[model samples]
Target: MKQSNRKVSGTLRVWSGVVAATLLAGCGGAEPVHPDEPFPQTQEQAQENVAAAPIVESMDAIALDRTLTSRTRSLIRARLAQGQAQVHQQVPVVSDSGQQLFLNDQGLNGDVTAGDGLFSAIGDVDFVTHQATQDRIREFQARNPQRPLMASTFDNRVRVSTRPLTALSPSVFQPGVPIPIFPAGITFAVKPANSLIITDASVINDPTRTYDPCSNSGNPNGVWTFNHLMREMANTYVSPSVLTEHWLRQWTVNQNINGWTVPARTAMMPYILTPWPRVGGALDLTRSPFKLVAIVNRLDLGGGRGPAGYASGNAGELRFVFAAVDRTSGTCGVRPFLVIFEYGVPHSSCDAVKTWAQRWLELSAPSMVLGSSAYNAALASLTQQVVVRNAAPRKPNGSAINQIRTNEEWLRYPWELREFHLMGSGPSVNRLQGQPTVLTPGDAHNDTPVLRDFINANTPAILANTYTVPTTFPTASTPFLGAFPWIASDTTSFWRATGISVNEARHKFSLNTCSGCHGRETKTGFTHIDEFGTLSPFLATGMSDPSIAYVVQDPVNTSLNREFFEIEMRASKLDSLANQSCLASAFHRRLTSAH
Candidate 1:
C-alpha cells in the first residue's frame, strides 16, 4: 500500500490536491441508485448491487446467557446509580467544571495509599515492591479461581520485545509523531545477545532469525510481553469465528519506528506473549477458543499525549503513571500504561458453563503489573471507589456531589471509551441478552439525527438497552440501531456473510459509532487500515473509462464503498495460524496438578 494510502489516526491526513468528482457523478440524478454508492443505475441494477454484499448464514446464530447478562447489567447499573446519587448529595453546590466535585467527593476514598506508594517505586523496580505485587497476584488468583495463572507452570508461554529493530534505520522520522518500535515482519529473538541492538541488514531479513515469545528469558527492558498460549490460539485460523489476519490487525497500526514511518501490523506481537496468571483458561471465546483477545498499549506520553491516543484528563494525574528504569544501564523513561480490563465469563457464549470465562477488554486506568497480583487488587480498589462513591449518602456538609456520573454507561470508564468493545457477537451467543434492538432500514440509513439523539439522550428505553447485555439482539427481520455487526462477526466470511444490508451496516458502524471520526468515510467496516479501493486512483479503476479521474467526494460514501467491496472480495487473509492444544493441555495439566 502507498504511504499516502495508510489510514490516518485521530486526525485524517490525506493527500493535498486530489480533487474527487467523477466518482460521485449522478448521485443527485433522479435515477435509482445503490443506497450505499451514488452510481446511478436502473431498478434491476440496484437490486443486483444490493445482492453483491456478503450475507450472514442466519440472523440468530449465537446463543447467550441472558439471565447472567441481565443480572450483571443490573448490578453494574445499581452501583453506577449509587455513585451518581452520592455525587449529587455530597455536592449540593456544584461547580461548572465538576473537577473539584470529583476529587473532593469523599465517599470512595480509601484510607491506605499503598497503591500510590507501590506505584512510586516503579522506577527502581524495587525488590520489596515486586514481592508485594507477587503476593497480590497470588491472593487475586485464590479469590478468583476462574482466572488461573498459566505461566507459573509453563515457562515458555510468554514473549517479550527486547529492543526496537535498528536495521530499518529510520531517518527523517519526525520525533513529534509517536514512534512505533515494532515493525511489520521484523525478526525478533527470545533473548538479547551480547549486543542488545541488532543492526545487520542480512540477519534482519532472515526469517529463520525470528524468536518465539514462549522462549522469553525475562527481559526487564522489554517493550511488552504476551500470553503466548492465547497468541497461539488467536493466531490459529478457524472458520468464521477466528480470522488470523483480524487477530494480527488488532495489534498493527501505523507508527514511526527507528526513524522509519511505516505501518506496524505486528508490533503488538508482545501483547499476545503476555504471561498467563497463576490460574488458567479464565478467558474463553464466545465462538472459537481464540475469540477473546487482549491489548496492552504503552501510553506514548513523551509528546504530551494522554492514554491511548488522546490528551489525558485531570492534568495527567488520573493516568497510572510509572517510571521504568534500566537497572543495569541506569537509563530511565517515565512510562504510564493501560491494559484491557479483566472480567470473567462462562465458557463459550453458546454453551456457558458453571465456570465463567474471564476476559480483559476495556482499558483500566489504575496501573499494576500485567497478570500479576496487583492488577486485580487495583481494579477492585477502583471498582470499589466507583460503586461506593455513587452509593454513599451525602457528606456531613449535606451538599450533593455527582462526581463521575455520566448518562452513558460506556462513558463511565472515562478513559477507555475510544477502544472498548463490550462483547463479541456470534451465532452461538445470539440470544444472550444485552444486544440492543435493531433499527429499521429507514431509521438506520437516513435517520442520522435519531441515531445521534438515541445515543446522547439516554432515555429510559435507550438506557435500558444501551450498555447492558441486551435482553434481545437484532436479526435479519430486525437489525441493531447502530452499525454494531461490523465490529466483530462470527461469520465464516466477514462483510460477505449474509445478514444486514450494506447501507444499514455502513451507517451503524461508521456514523453512529464514533461520529465517523478516524477518517470515517475511508474505513472498511470498523477497521481503520486501508484495504478497500475507495481512494482516488482505485475508485476510478472500475469506471467505464479507467483513464477518467474519479474519487468518492463525500467521505461518508467513500467509507461505504470501501466496506462494500471488503465483503464482496473476501480480501482479508492471514499468514499462518499456530494450533492451541499444546498450551491448552499444559494449562489443564498444571491446574490438575495444583488441585
Candidate 2:
C-alpha cells in the first residue's frame, strides 16, 4: 500500500481549540461592543468586557519551555554520554600548543628535562631532579649506544645520542606517515616508527618532534600532540556533563600505551587518524557517549522578556547563557565554537548565567588529548534531531503534495502539456491588481496563449502563502497572555536533549510563515484561516498577502531562502532511494560504545 502522507490528522482541531481558548481570553468576558467603542487596553479590562475568557495563566509555561523538547533531550543525552566517554581520564602528553613536554604523573616522574628537551637517564644522578635527568640519558643509550653522551657548552646539557635531532617538519600531523628524525635513538615499534627515545644530559634539538610520533603532514611543527595542546584546540570544545567525564576516561584508557611514558601518545594516535581528528578520535576511542551541555532553572519573565518569548518590558530581561569549547591543537585552527542560550532572567545577573554556561563549556571542552570526530559527530547527530524534530511538517492539506506532483509532471514528458496550471484559491488571488490568466486544473485549455494569460492573472496568488504572516499559528498576542502546552512539552524535550537554551529553536519555528496559517485572525476571535476561512467575518480585513518580493529583497529573508534551497538541493543530490530513505529515517543509533 502507498504510504499515507498524514502523520497528524487532528492538528486542525487541536489548533482550533487553542484558538478558541485564546479568543475567549482576549474578549475578557465582555459582550461584543460596537465597532466604534475602543477595545480594552489591558487584558483584564478585555476580560471584563467579554464573557468567559479562557484562563490563560495555566499555559504560560508553553512560552517558557518552547525550546526544550523530548527529542532534543534525547540527542543531548546521547552527546553527553559520548563526550564523557571520550574525554575523561586521558593524560595530556604535550603542552597547550602541542609543542612542549607535558605527560602523565608516572611519565613525568621517570622523564628528565635539559635545555628545553626531555630524556631518560642511564644511571643515578646526585638529586631527584638529576636522577630523573640521568634515567632519561640511560634510556636513550640503551636504544642507541653508537653515540655516547657528548657534553654541550651549556651546563647540564648533554648530547647522549649520536643520532642528530631534527625539527618538526609540518604544521599539522597526518596519519600513517613516518615521522622524520635527524638523530635516531630508541625507535618505538609503533606501526609508523616515529617514536623516539632520549638520554639524560642530552638536549633534544627538537623537543616538539620527540614527543609527537604521529605523521607531521597536517601539523608541520608537530604541534598536534595529545597533550594540553589537544586540550587547547579552539575547535575541540564540548558541553560539560556527567557523560563528558565518562568519554574522557574512555579515551584515556584507549590511548594508554604499554610502557609509554607519555600516556597521551596512545590517545592522540587515534585522533590523528580521524577527521576533525581530535574530538572525533576521542569520541571513537571512548566509544561515543552522551553528556549534558546545560540546563534551565527558571525563566525570570514569563511575559515577553526572554529570548524565546515576545518582548514586553525590557529586551535584556533574559539572563541565561549556554556555552561549549574544544581544545586540541593550534594548527587545528578551528575557533572555539560557542552557542549562547538566553533565558528570561534580568541581564544584570548575566554573570550567574555565564557561570552555568562555563560549567557546561568546561565539561565539554576536550582535555590533554586530541578529541576525535566521534564527539563532533555526536554533537552533529544531536543537532540534526533538533533540526528535524522542530522543522514544521508540510501543510496537512494535500496542497503541498499536489504542488510536488504538479512540479514533477512539468519535469517529465515536457511535450505532454503545452501550458502549466497552478491550482488553489483564496484571498491570495486578490493581491493581483491585474495580471494574465493561466489554466487552472478544472479549466480545459492546454494551449500556450491560455497558459500565458493564466500566469499573468494568477502570479500574485502563487506568491501568496510563501511570504504571508508566517505559517505558524500565533498562540498569544501580548507576551504571556496565553499558554501553549505543546510549547512547554517541546521545551522540556529540548532541555533533556542538549542542556542548552531551547529559546532559539522556539523563536525560529514560531516565526515560521507556515505556522501562521493556524493563528486566529484577531486577538479576540476564534477564527483561523486554515479552518474557518469563509466563516471568519474579519477575513476581508484581517488577511494580507505577504510580499514575495520582500523575501527576495531582504538580506535576512534571502539568506533564509538560500539555506532552505540548499537543504532541498542536498536532499535531491542523493543518488539512490536507499540513501534518501536514510536521510528521512527516524531510527536512532547509539553514537557510543557499550563499554
Candidate 3:
C-alpha cells in the first residue's frame, strides 16, 4: 500500500537537465533571497528579483524537481488509475474507541497511528472551556431524547433577499455590480425529509451502528450522521483558535454569572436572542445560479473482507460521499466519494480538522484561516511557506482546506469506478436485478459516476434529457459534468508531487475555484470577509428586523463577512434547538470569554 521510494526515469531524465540549464541561464546569476530577509539595496540586486518573482520565463530547479516528480509518478498513477490494482490499497477505519485502523484490499490490517499537529496530542485542549463545552454536548444529548437531529431540523421561516453588488462590496467587483453567486428568485426548502437530512438523534448519538442499504428500509447511499455534520460545521464555521483557546478556564469557581461554568451559564442565561418570528416564505434551490449540494458520509461497508470489514452487514464503515444535485436536467447528478483514506477518520474527523487549522493558523507565523486569501497566497509561494505533506510518513493528517484530498489519497472516488456503477454496465453491471439499466451511454473516461448513477436510478421520464460532461472549466453550461476539472485544479500540489504532465499540472493549477469567482481586489489585506454579500437570509427584510431578528451582527449590506457571521451565529442557535443542547450558549461564551 505504500509508495516505493525507488526512483525511475524515462524521457523526463533528459528534460530535467535541459530545464535546469534553461532556468539557470534565465536566472542571470541572481542569488536567491530568503523570504524573511531584507531586500537587497542595489539596483543590480533589485534586477535579480526575477529569480524569485511570480512571473518566470523559465522553470527553476525547484519547478524542475516538481516537474520530474510529477512525471515520475508511474507508481502513483498505477495506484490511482483504474483496474483491480486498487483493491489492494489501504482502507482507513476508526474503531469504536476512536482508534484508527487501516485495512488493505486483502484485508490485511495496519497499526493505529496519529499524524503531526494537534491530533498527536488528542486529549489536550488549549482552552479549559473547550473541554467543558464538549462535556455539555454530551449532557444535553442525554437529557433531550426528543430533540431532533441537528441535521434534520432546518428552519424555513427566514426569507432570502438579493442585495445589490454595491451594497455587498463597494470596494471591489464594482462597476458591473451585483454579481451574486446565485441568480435571483431561488429559495431553499424549510426542511428536507428526515431520510434526506439524517437528523435522528439516536442515530447520531450512537456511532457504532451500521447504516443499512436503502432497499432494507435504511437511509440511502449518501447520509451524514450528526457526529460528522457537527465536525464539518466546526471545521468550516468556527475558527480553530476559537475551538482551541479562550473561555476554557477552570470551571467557574462559584458557578457565577459572567464567570459561570458553561452549563451553569446555559441554564441561567436566556437565549442570547429570541428566535425570529415565523415568516411565510420559501426559496428554490433549483433556480438559476443556485446549485443543490448534498454531502453524505457513510460507514464503509468493506464487503465482509476481514477484521476491519463491515460491508455485507450493516456495520459502521468509513467513507464519505459528496454530490452536486443537478435539478436542471433531472437526469444527471454528480456524486463523489472521498477518494483518499477509505476510512473517514483522521481526514473528516473534527480533531484532524482542528489540527490542520492549527498548523495553518497557529503553528506558523502570520497564520491564516483555511480559505483566506492569505492562506492561498502562502501556498502559492514556495519560499514563504513552511513545508507540509499530504498523508502518511509525513503525517497522516489532512486539512479542512484540502477538500480535494483527505490525505495522500486523492480526495475523490475514482472516476472510472463511479462511471461504471452509473452505466450499470461495468464490473458489477449484473448486480442489478430490477433497477433500470442506463438509458444513455456514458463515457467511461469522461463521464462522471454520479451523473451515470442518476440516469440508471431514475426513469427516462424523470431523467428526460441526456446530460453531457462540461468541456470548459468552471462553466455552468452542462448539468451532468464531472468535477475532475475542479478536483484537478484543487490538487495541483499532489499532481506535481506525483510528477504528472505539464498539461495535467496546468489543468490542476490554472483554475481559481474559490476566490476567482469571488475576488475582491480593492480591499486592503482583507481576508475572505471582504467578499460581496449577494444573497443572504440575514439581508432579507424578515431576518434583519430587530424585533424578531436572528442575526446578531449589524448588517453592512455590502460585506459577505457580516452575513457569514450572522449565519454562523444563527446556525449555532439552531444547533442548540435541534439537539436540545446548550452548545449555542457555550459557543457564544467561547467566542466572547476573555479567560
Candidate 4:
C-alpha cells in the first residue's frame, strides 16, 4: 500500500517555519535568541565529560548536511536545542552516538560562523562510538562471524531503536457516548497499568499460557498481564514452526553481569529482564539496576471484506509494550522490547472488529477496578475471540512486497514476518508484518531497493519540509493509522544514507519501523513505555525525557518537538472504532488511503 504524501495542515501550520530557524539559531528552536546572552558551556566542563572515557573523535567546525541520516541530524539538532537554554555561551555539541565535546560556531574552535549553518565542535567526524559500545559490537561480531559489522551495518541502515507496546470483543462492547477520544466513564488500562510494577519476572510468567491477555495474569497480584498472549504468539503464531523457547535468548551472557546466574549465562537467558531480589530491598523502576515495565492496549486495524483479499481479513491487534528499565546497566540486552498479538477482534467485518474495540474502551474505563470479576469478564469476552494461529501466503521477490513462502517453518528469525501472525522487537533488531522486505532490519539482501535508498538517503528532499512517501509501501490489510502503525534496528551508527524524512512521509514511514519511531523520527528515546510509576510518552502527553532545554525541533512533523502524546492518537482510534458507525468507515478503501 502506498502511503499518502499529504501533510497534516494543522500540524504544518504550527510547524511552518521552525526548521529553518533551528538551522541557524542552533538550539533555541522557535524561541528568539538575544544578542547579549552567552552560551554557558566551558572547555573545562567539556574535558571533564571525556576525562574518564576515551575521546574517539574530535571536531572543531561541523556542518550538518542531508547526507546524514535523520537520527544523527536530529540528535545533533536536539543537542543544540539543549544548549539554547543558555544563549550567548558556548553551544554544547554531542554526536548522535553520545560523544560530547566542546563545539560551537563562535569561530573560536574553527567554526566559520554561527549563522552559516556551521558548528564548531571538538569532534573529527559526524559518527563516533565509545569504547564501551565498541566492546558490545565485538561481542556480537565474535559470534556472528558471517555478518560483517561495518559493511553489513553500513549497507543495512541499522541502529538501536528507542523502544515500544493491547485486546477485545463481541456485541457486548457496543458503543456508548462518543465524548471525544477518551470517554468519561472509561478507564484506559494504560493509566492504571503504569502504576502496576513488575519487580519480579514471575509477574509476567504465565507458564501454563492459560491466562487471558486482556485481564491480569491468573495471579491475583498481577494487575497488568499479557504473558500468556506473548507466550502463545511467540511460541505458536509468530513463526511458521512453533517455538516453545521463543521468549528465551541463547546468547552467551559474559557481558556486564547484572542478574543472570552462572548457568543462565551460557544457557538461554531471558532477553526480557526484571529487577530481582531487590537486593536493596525495594526500589522503583528508576533506581533498579534492571527492571521490566509493562503497558497494554488494543488497536483496531480495520474491518476486512468478507474473507481475505488485497484488503480483506483485517482485524484489530493487541499491543504489549515492555519497557526494559535501562537507567541501570547490563548490555546482555536490557533494551526496551515489544510484542504484538494478532486478531484481537473478529475478522468477519470492520464493524465486528469495532464491537470488540468498544468492549476494550469499557474495560479501560477508570471506574473499572483492577481485580473485580467484571474486569475479568470484560477481558475474557475479548481475549476468547482472539486468533493467534495464522499462516503466510506465497510472495514474490519484489522490493515493495514481502517475500515469505507458504510453508510451516515459523519465521526462522526473530523479526521475519509476512502476515499478521505475531511481531516482536528484541533489544537490537526488529521487523514486522506488512512492511517492505527492503526495510527488513538486518537482512543484507542481493541489492538495496530504490525505495530503501530514498528513505535513508540524507538528501535535500527532507529540507523541503515535506516527505514523499513511497507508493510501494506494504500493507497486509491494516486499515487505520497512528504512532507505530503497520505494527512496526542495528548498531552499527544510524549513519545510513536511508533515514528519517519529513512530515507525512517521515511519520508514516519512520513510525512504521521500530527504529524510526524510537529514534529522532518522533523525538523519542529508549522506550515509548520507558517510565516507571509515571506514564510513558506513548500514553502520557510528552516526548521521551526531554529534561534538557531546547529540544531540537522535530524536523519531520515539527509539532512534537517538546510534547507528543501517542495516546491521543490511539484514543481517537478507539473512539472512532467504538463510536463511529462502522458502516461509514467499513467501505472499500484504496491501497493508498486505507491506512
Candidate 5:
C-alpha cells in the first residue's frame, strides 16, 4: 500500500519474471515468458492462473452444475428452452478485481465432457489487468521475496444474474424485470400534469380528478383510460384528505420537495415511477425494490430472521419503482430519493396478482392506444378494486407502522433513515438510521456514523460463508460501504450469491441503495432514468456492456466490475423465473374478485 513497498515489489516482480522465463525455457524449449510478466500476464490467460496471489490453483476447488441451487437449475433450463441464454458457467468465480473464470461446455476450453450440463474451464491465468489483481501479485512478492514461481486461481464478484444478458421486454420470449416506461401509454416522464412526479405539496391540480377508475364508471367493459388511471393514482396524494396527510406530507416526501422555489408548485417533484415485469408469480425477486429495497424477498434478508420473515411470503405484489430525478425548473433542487409502492394484489391472491401484472403488460405495449375504450375497460378492474393498506408509508409523529418495529419488512423511513440500506441480515433490511431519529435537516447524502459502524462490524462474518448465499451469522458490526468501494480484506472468499469477492458484494449492495447508486459511488448524475425518456450514461451504458472495464464510481469510493450489468441482469433473472414452472394454488379455488 505504501509507495516504498510498491517500488520494492516492482523490483522483485521483474526479477521473478526473469527467473520464471528461464525455468520455462528449460522445460524442453517451452515458450519464453516475457520479463514484464511474472505469470498470468494476459486478460484471457489470467482468469486461470494468479501466480502473484497466495491462492492455490485447484481446478476442482469449484464445483459442478449439480451443485447449483434448485432455482438456478430451473433458471438455466428455462433459458435453454427459450432458444437463448446459451452460456455455460460453473463458478462465475471472479477475482477481487473483475476477471471471471470462464468455465465452458466446449471440450476445447478445459471441459472433460463436452455435452454434459456441467461446465469446466481451466485457469490459463497468464496475466493481470486490474488493480486488485496487480495488488495481489505485489502482495505475493512481498510474502515470498525470493521464492520459486507457482500457479494460482482468480476471483471477482457482485452476485449478478448468471443468465445471458437478455434485452428488457414484456413479451414472454424476451423477458426482463423493469419495464422502461418509454413508448408505453403510461406516465413515463417525471413532470407535473404530463406525468406522475411524486412530491409533498400539490400545485397544479388536475381538472379531472378521478380517484377510483371503477367508481361511477359508465364504461360497459369496465375500464378507464391510461391517462385517467395516472391521474387517479396521483390524486390519491390529495384526495380523500387523510391519505394526503400520511402518504405525502412528511419524511423524504417532505425533504424531496422542501426547498423548491417554484411559485405555485412548492413541492420539488423528484421521482419517476415504472412497473416491474412478471406474471403468475414470475417477477424476479433478486433485483432492486425486491432484492435490495425496503420490502424484500426473504432470501434477500440476512441474519436468522430471513427464514422467519419468508415463512409467510406468499402475497402477490404490484411494484411501482420510483427513481429520484432532478428537474431543470426553479432552483433545480431536489433531495435524492428512491421509493417503491408494493401494491398487494387485489384480494391478496397471487393468481389475481398475475392477472394484475398481465394487464399492465398489455397496457405497456406501444401498439395499443391508452385512450381507447377497450384499454379503459381493462384498467377499471385494478383501479376500482385496489386498496392502500394500513401498512402504507408515513404515520403520526413521522413514525412507522408495521408488524414489528424490528421485523417489519414493509416500513418506509424518513429521508435520514432510508438514505442507505444493508440487506440479507436480521431485520433483513437495515435502514441507515441515525442514533436519535432526526428529521430537521434531511438528507445526510452519505453513510451516517450509525451505518458505517454496522457495515464495518459485519463484513468478515459475511465472507465466512462466501461460497454460499451470503447470510451473515448476525455479527454486531456488519460490513460497511459507501461513496467509496470497501473490500473486506478477505481476498480468497467469494459470495455464492454472485460468485464475486466480498468487496464486489459490497459494491452491488451499495449500488442498489438510493444514495449510493445515485451519487458519486456509481458516477451517476441526476437520475438513472430521467424525464423525457433520457437515461444517465451509467444506466444506459452499463446495461448493455457486460465486459466493459468501467469502474463503479459513486460519491465516496470506486470499485471494479465483473458482471454488474444492471438491467441486463434483472431482465435475465426475470426471464429465467418467468420460464420456471410453479405449482398452482387450487386452480379453481373461490377467489375474491375485488376489495
Candidate 6:
C-alpha cells in the first residue's frame, strides 16, 4: 500500500498556507524582554525555590488549565492547528532501505520512467525494456557459485559410423559375463523388542541414539543459544507489561532526577566530550536528548522497549523511573521525565543474543551498574535546582521566563494523537476501544512549529523572561510541546513510507500525539475502531481497517479519500472557530469571498 503523494489535500491546502505565514510572522517578533531589565536571580536561587515547592499529584485538565493562562492556551491551540497543517503538507519520501528523500512533484515525476531511446513502448504506450535471457543467465551464474551444469549429448556422431564394423561383428553374448553391479549387503537379524544389542566401541561412543538428552555434555564452553540468552535477558528485565506501567507511573509523578544518573547523559558523554571522532562531529545534545535517556546494558533486560509492543510485543520493555532528591531536605520523590524502552526475542540462529549480551556486558559494565545512594544524591541536587527555578515567578522585565515556561508546559503535554483521543472521551466512555489516531514523538521531519507556537501562546505565565545557568532542566519558557508534533510527524512519515495507510497512519500518529500528553495510562484505551462506530473486532488490527474486512484485509488505506475526509473535517472545524473569532475576521472574509 502506498500513501498518496498529496499530503495536504483540498481543505488542508488553505490552512497550511495560513499556518506557514503565521509562523513566519511570529518568528520575526522582537524578543519578549528588554535588555535594560535587571538580570534574573542566580541559578542556585531558582533551584532552591523549586526544591521548596510542593509536588503535584495528578496532571488532569484542571491542573493543566489552571497552570496555563489564556495567552498560553491560545498559543497551544494555534500551534496544534499549525502542526496538523505542517504534518499534512510534508510528504517525506523514504525507501525500504531507510533512505529518506524530500518529495515534491518534481521528485515524484523523476521516479517514473518515460519513453526513451533505450526503452520501448509497451501496452497503452507504457515504456518497457527487454534484456536477453543469456545476459540474465550470465549474471545469475556470476552471483551463484554452485550452479549445476545441464547434461547434454553431441548430435554429430561420426565416430558412431566408424564403430559400424564392431556392430557388424555383434553376435550372441556370453552367458556368464560378470556385471558391474552395485554392492548389496545382507540385512542384520532382528533382535527381540526388549533385548539390548550393541557393539562395544559404538555403544561407548554413541550411547543411546534414540534417547540421549545430554549429547553435547563434553562441550561445556559452547556458544550460548539465542533462545537461552533471550530468556536470560527477559528474566533480567521486568516484563514489558510491568515495565510500561513503571515508566507511565514515573512520568505521571513528574519526578525530578539527578542529571548524572540520567542514562542519556552517560550515553551521550562520549559524543559530547569527543565530538570530532564521530561521523557528524560531536553529538548535538539539543537534537539527541534521547541519548541522555538511553542506557546500553550488558544485562539482558536493560534496553527499553519501543512502541511496536502495543501489538505483537516486538517492542521491548522500558522501565523509566524519575526521582527527585532534595539534598537540603534529604527527601526524594517522583518527577516528570520521558522514558522509552523496547523488548523482543533476539534474532539469532544460535547463541546470537547470548554472544551479544555477553559482549555488551563486558563493554558497558562500568556505566550499567548504578548505586542507590549516588543516584539519589545526583537526582536530589538536580531536582532541587529544577523545582526551585521552575517554581519562581517570572520577572516582569523580560520574556525569557515566559519562553522557558512555554517549553516546560509543552513538554508536560507533548503533542500526541492519544491525548486528543482521551480529550474526546471521558471516564463514562468504555476505554477498551482506544483512540483512532496513532501518534509518534520527535521532529525527524521538522513539523512541530505550530504546536510549539500554540504552547508558547497558551502558557504565558510559565514563560521565562530571563536566562538562568544550567539551562538543561525544564523551564517556564522551554518549548517542550513545540518539538513534540514535529517528532510525531517524522515518525508518522517513516511509518507511512513503509506502506501504511493514511487512516491507520493517522491513527498511530494520533496515538503517539495523545500519549505524549496523556501518558501510558491511555495505552489500553487506545483500541482500534470500525467505521460503523463499533470497537475493532479483529485482534490483529493495527493498519487493518475494520470497516472493510474484504479485499484481502489491507490495513493500510493507500487512497486519498480517507486523508481528504480527515483534512476536510479538521479544516471545517478550524474554519468554524475562526469565523467566531475577531482575529480571523480577515480570514473569514477571504473564505466567504472564495465561496
lDDT of 5 by residue, 290-403 (tens): 111121111111011111111112223332323332323333222244343333322223233334334444543455444344544444444444422222222211111111
Ranking by lDDT: 4, 5, 3, 6, 1, 2
**What's the candidate order when arranged by decreasing TM-score?**
4, 5, 1, 3, 6, 2
The residue-level lDDT of candidate 2 at 244 comes to 25
In candidate 3, stretches whose alpha carbon ends up further than 4 angstroms from where it belongs are 1-93, 100-350, 353-595
lDDT score of residue 173 within candidate 2: 17
The sequence of per-residue lDDT tens digits that candidate 2 reaches over residues 186-296 is 111111100000111111112432122222222223221122111211111221122123322322332211111112213322332233233532433221111112221
Per-residue CA lDDT of model 4 for 521-560, tens digit only, reads 4444434444232343443442221111223344434465
TM-score on alpha carbons, each prediction: 0.20, 0.15, 0.19, 0.38, 0.34, 0.18
486 Cα displacement, candidate 6 (Å): 18
Best by TM-score: 4
Model 6, residue 288: C-alpha shift (Å): 36
lDDT, candidate 1, 1-595, per-residue tens:
2232132111112212211101110100001001112211222332232222111110000001122111111000001112233322221110111111111122122101221110000000112222232344455456656644221111111111122112212321221221111111111100111011111222211122111222222321111112322222222222222222243343355432212232232423333213221124332121111110112111111111111111111000111111111112233221112222211110111111101111111112134233334543333333222122112122111101111100111111111111221222232321111112122112133334433433343333222111211111233333233222222211111111122234333333332232232223333232221111112222222222211222322343334232122110100000000011100110110000000
User: Residue 212 of model 3: what lDDT?
Assistant: 22
Q: Model 1 segments beyond 4 Å from truth?
A: 1-231, 234-453, 459-515, 521-527, 531-595
Candidate 2, superposed: residue stretches over 4 Å from native? 1-326, 330-336, 346-595
Q: What lDDT is obtained when candidate 6 is compared to the true structure?
A: 0.20
Clashes in each model (backbone N, CA, C under 3 Å)?
A: 75, 133, 25, 42, 54, 111
Candidate 2 TM-score, C-alpha based: 0.15
